[model samples]
Target: MPMVDTGDVRLHVQRMGPRDGHPAVGTVLLVHGLLTDSLASYYFTVAPAFAAAGLDVVMYDLRGHGRSGRPPTGYTLDDAVDDLAALLDRLAVTGPVHLVGNSYGGTVAFGYAARHPERAASVSLIESEPATAAWAAKLDGILRRVQRELAYNETDALAWITVNRGHNTARLARGAARLARETTLVRDIPASSVLTEDGMRAVGCPVLGLYGGDSDLAALVPWLEASLPDCRTVVVPGHEHSVLVEAAGTVGGHVLALIEGSGGRGPGRVSIPGGGGGRASGAAGPAVR
Candidate 1:
């Protein structure tokens, strides 16, 4: 277990380089979603594939999640963005790097791009959106519900989750309950500052949005394409919010295309199947070698 003390909080970090002593084509930083998510999501899914494809991969547990230091405060989006910047600085990776974020992690990645546009090579948002007013409100409602149902009604909630979502999910839910009860994460996140339209438009790097066709978030594709300077989106068919985990191949393919298109060196051709209103055929194209 590797950890980096970022002055603000100690973040649990994981890094993987290209196989067989090959130089990395580029660097990729993977950020996971809030609560029930950690670097494990990408580690078990896309991280290895990216590394095998000759990209350096970096993943970390955010503050108050996984094995990272949880201060019971500083759970704002800015804190997350700052942590990323600091982590990269400490790791001595100063060049612009590709960023792949899941759910709330995408929001943080978007925030990082907006804040430090020069350092972001590209951003791939998997079932995520920017930290806008609407996003904040949505998070507020969700957090409140979690605090009420998971924290306030712990025993019943765990029992229900164990029966419905299985013991693994129930165990994760138990940790979430402790986080919500012991930390200010539920409040700090909603109160974090949101980005304005101008702020969003300032991020000039290439952006990729991957959403499930059946997810309500698919509705944002049009807005994302319209808002970002260089934005492309894909709606994966027959999936929902958990698309990254459920459809890692599709997600990995699209993300690899974005990374290659952004200037990483690779032999294969990059082709994205869906954009805007189009739906992906569920083929993730050729596997990266």
Candidate 2:
């Protein structure tokens, strides 16, 4: 584990290279979701697989999460994107790299791709969407509810989560509560400037979106495909927002397919079946659910 000072925030980063002293095929940056999520998600799930596939893997804890430096302010989406850029500069990863992001991290990855399209080889979003006014409103509602239930009613909330979601989830929720109560994360994220449809369409890199068939976000697949120029989406059946962890193999396989497909030429709509034991359908073709 190494900590890199990005001038503004110190990010905790982890890197995994191809095994057997082989040269990496390319680089893949993994970004985890907000609160209760860190590089550990990818470390425990897809990071090793990506590395084993001969790709350089980079994972980092976002500011105010995991082992990263948590400032009281500056938790906007823009701030997170800046942190990614600064981290890449510090690590000297100059070439175009595949970007894989989960949840809020997906939003950050999309923003980075939008801002630096030349450096983005491709983007894979798992259960995520681009930042928009609707996204902001959704986040505002979720954060407010978290503040009310978890922060304001801490003991009861933790107790309920422990009973329902298990002790580990309760522990994570505790940290999330502290983050919401102590920092400006809840406020800044909702207030972050959103991207217009034009802005999203401007990103020329190949984009891949993976969504859980049962997840509400699956509905956004059509919009994403329609919005991005060279975008493809997969809907993994019988899962929800936690599909990244629940079906790591499926997610990683789709991402790797996108990375490999985008290597020489532009990626077209292709359906790759049976990578991590789960079946996936292309959202562009038919509705999975």
Candidate 3:
């Protein structure tokens, strides 16, 4: 429940690993997807692997998304990017960082790294799409559904979520539903980010794009992996938008590979454990999808 004042806003953030770890090599920042918080959405899986691999982990709720302050306005992705820069500045942990982002979080990471190329040591993106023309209509469709669910105090919305996302716990489903209707500060942030694709070409660091082989968004993998000069991607089979949890080991391997590649420590070979792989050309070579 630690809150840091990022000058413009107070952000709710959490950390893992030893306090004594050096910021340069051990710090990682985990950015959660659209409607969830740092703890509930990201910490359960991604953070631990980094911590176990001798790195410190940091995560914060985007404004209005989790335990962070729900501002009356300012939910744009640029706002989120500013929030991230503000937090990093506040912590003073200035080093090329290892960034892991999921869904909209991935776009946020992409935006930040593109805007501030010097701050990234490496990056990992899961179930994420580059800011492209393909995203506008897709976002409209998601927002329309989200708005429709909110029109009735979220009863129908909750039901729709339950039927569609039945794999999540009841508490998580309800919590997400409640956040949808009650939190307004972070709404439209993801949709707004879809309006730009110029930023997509700005990324120049080692990056891994993650998606479920079965997910609808998986189709965008080729465009992104090939476009970025130093980027590649992996797709987990039999999973969808929820690739992080559905395929933790495979996802974990990719995260590890990205970190290793960033540090110039490739393992000589990467094994998928139980999923398929995609090939891309870059300094790091092809990795497990």
Candidate 4:
């Protein structure tokens, strides 16, 4: 368990690579979403796959989540981006590298790429949209609802999910409830801004997007197509927002492909254990990653 001090806070960070000891071509940073999400989301799922594919993998618990120092404030998007920048700086991770983010993590990746295009080699977004006014407003509504539910009925909500939903669902609900009850996540996320159209257009790196066919965020894929200069997307069938969990192998395959392509390397020969070929047909062209 290593923690990197980013001046403002200390982030719980982990670095991993292939057990066979192949040299890593470039770095791949994994960022998770809001609420109950943590570095573990990627740590236990896709990080090892990237490592096995010969890329240095980095993942950190965001402020107010996991084992990271949880300051009461500084949970906004700008703060999140700054934290990433500082982490990279502290780790001496220069040059362009691939970024893989899930949900809100994806939004941070987009924002960071737009802010510092020179440092990003490529980006892979999972079930995420640009932080636009519309997204911010929509997120605000969702956060408010979560805040309301957590403020008054968190225990009941957890109990209800435990009985009605599966154990994983109950666990996630409990974690979300505890975080909501303890941290300023509910207050800070709603205050963050989604990137504008111009901001989205500013990201110059190639991007790979993975989304669930049935996810609410899938609607943002067309917007990504219209905005990013080079974007490839895949919509996995029979999945939803939890693509990272439901289809980790598929997501990991695409990500390894992205890293391999970005580094101008040959195909990475690793199989996603339970991952299917979750690629949607007619994905802008043949799968580049």
Candidate 5:
């Protein structure tokens, strides 16, 4: 459970790969969604695939989520990206590194790429949308539904989870309840800055947009194609918003391809001369969820 000081808050970060101390072909940062989501989603899903494919893997629990420090405020999109910049600086992860984000995490990656194009090798969004007004509106709808259906109080949420979703989903539901009760996420997110169309267009790197064929966010593919000059879009049939969880293997293959295609080449990739089999250096603190 190593934490990195971002000047503003402490972030729980996990780096994984072979411990052989091999230099990685490139670096890939995995960003998870909001609420109950944490680095564990990626850690258990696509991360190991990237690691085995000879890329450095970095995953962190976003502020106010998981083991990261949760402040009373500063849950805005801009704030999240700034925290990412500071973490990268602290870790001395120079050059253009791949950013792979799921759900709201994709918005963070998009914001970061827009602000720091020079530092981004490529950006991948899984079941995510650009932080546009439309997306904000959609988010509002989802939140409204959540408020109406789910309990914000820990006790009630746990009770609902146990009765409805059983033990497995209850675990995640409990975490979500804790975050809702303890943090300002529900309030801060609505007030967070949204990315304008101009902002989305400003990102100067290749983009990969993956969405479920039936997902509410599926429209984002056409949007990306119309906006980004170098964007690739993929739609997984028979899936919905939970593509990252339901179809992780398919998603992992796409990510590995991206790393192989862009993460080991010229300026976009960071070459680590002979160090073992392209393993990223372990974080200073022990790896934790």
Candidate 6:
């Protein structure tokens, strides 16, 4: 738990690596989705691969999420991206970094890339979408569910766990309230700022659009590939929205291939979904879906 001062914002960020290492294969800045902040989104996965690959992995809670400061209530996709940009600037993190965003994180990533193409190495989107009326409605439902769960008092927190999002619920009650109060996703995603899928095309780096190959995978993938020239798709044969927590290593392989390049220069067909995939980095792929 470390805090970085960005003049106007005190970002609560987490880092895992040596102070000085390989100048970082480019920092992997992960943005979590609705109801989830840092750590909860990546604690068991991804971080290790980036660390093992000798890259700096950084994750921070957006303005009103996690432990970050929450002023009255102001959170928007544009503002979240700006905060991210500011944090990077303050840390002197240069060059485009591999940006991994899940759920709503993907929304901010798309916005940031739209505004600053020079700041991205690549983008890995999980169970995500460009905001549309349909998308907004979908999110509205999830937000309502989250709010409902958060209503549980300490006495019923654990009992409320089973119906919630996380793959694990040992800390469900407290985590739910944290998520409920961190309404950045609710406050920002509902706006039209997130409706610009065209923005994804402006990014100057590689793009990996992933889906939980289950019945829920929207036509968004084909639509994205059709719209964004640099974008590609990967559908985990069997998975769902919370795929990250379910299958970390499996997901990492596909991500490493696209963003960092799997670099899996070995024997045989190294076909890791996403045609633009790189050589396998020796790290096993995480479970998809």
- In candidate 5 the C-alpha lDDT for residue 56 amounts to 88
List of clashing residue pairs for candidate 4: 131-194, 131-195, 132-194
Best by lDDT: 2
Alpha carbon deviation, residue 3, candidate 5 (Å): 1.3
Greater-lDDT candidate between 1 and 4: 1
Best by TM-score: 2
lDDT by residue (tens digit), candidate 6, 80-145: 778888999988888888888887787777667777888888888877765556777776776665
Local distance difference test, candidate 4 = 0.77
Using TM-score, rank the candidates from best to worst.
2, 1, 4, 5, 3, 6
Global fold similarity of model 6 (TM-score): 0.78
lDDT of each: 0.82, 0.83, 0.67, 0.77, 0.73, 0.65
Candidate 2 regions off by >4 Å?
A: 159-167, 262-278, 285-289
Per-residue CA lDDT of model 1 for 1-289, tens digit only, reads 9999999899999999997898999999999998777888888777877888899999999998889998989999998999999999999998999999999999999999999999999999999999999999999988887777785677876554344221267667777677888999999999999999999998999998888877788888878878889887777888788787777777887788788884322213222222122224532212100
Off by over 4 Å in 6: 18-21, 145-164, 173-175, 178-187, 195-197, 262-289
Model 4 TM-score is 0.88
For every candidate structure, what is the RMSD over all alpha carbons to the true structure, in angstroms?
A: 6.0, 3.9, 4.7, 3.9, 9.1, 5.9
Better of 3 and 5 by lDDT: 5
In terms of lDDT, model 6 sits at: 0.65
**Better structure of 2 and 6 per lDDT:** 2
Off by over 4 Å in 1: 156-168, 262-279, 282-289
Candidate 4, residues 165-253, lDDT tens digits: the string is: 22356666777676766777767777886676677878878898888777766666676777788887777766778878777877777
| Sliding window of 10 residues with minimal summed lDDT for model 1 | 270-279
TM-score of each: 0.88, 0.90, 0.81, 0.88, 0.82, 0.78
Error of 4 at 186 (Å): 1.8
lDDT of 2: 0.83
Between candidates 5 and 6, the one scoring higher on TM-score is 5
Q: On residues 1-289, what C-alpha lDDT tens digit does candidate 2 reach at each position?
A: 5999999989999999998899999999999887777788888778887888899999999999888998999999999999999999999999998999998999999999998999999999999999999999999987776677775678876655344221266667787777888999989999998999889987898898889888888888878878899988888887788887777777777787788884323323322222244435555544643
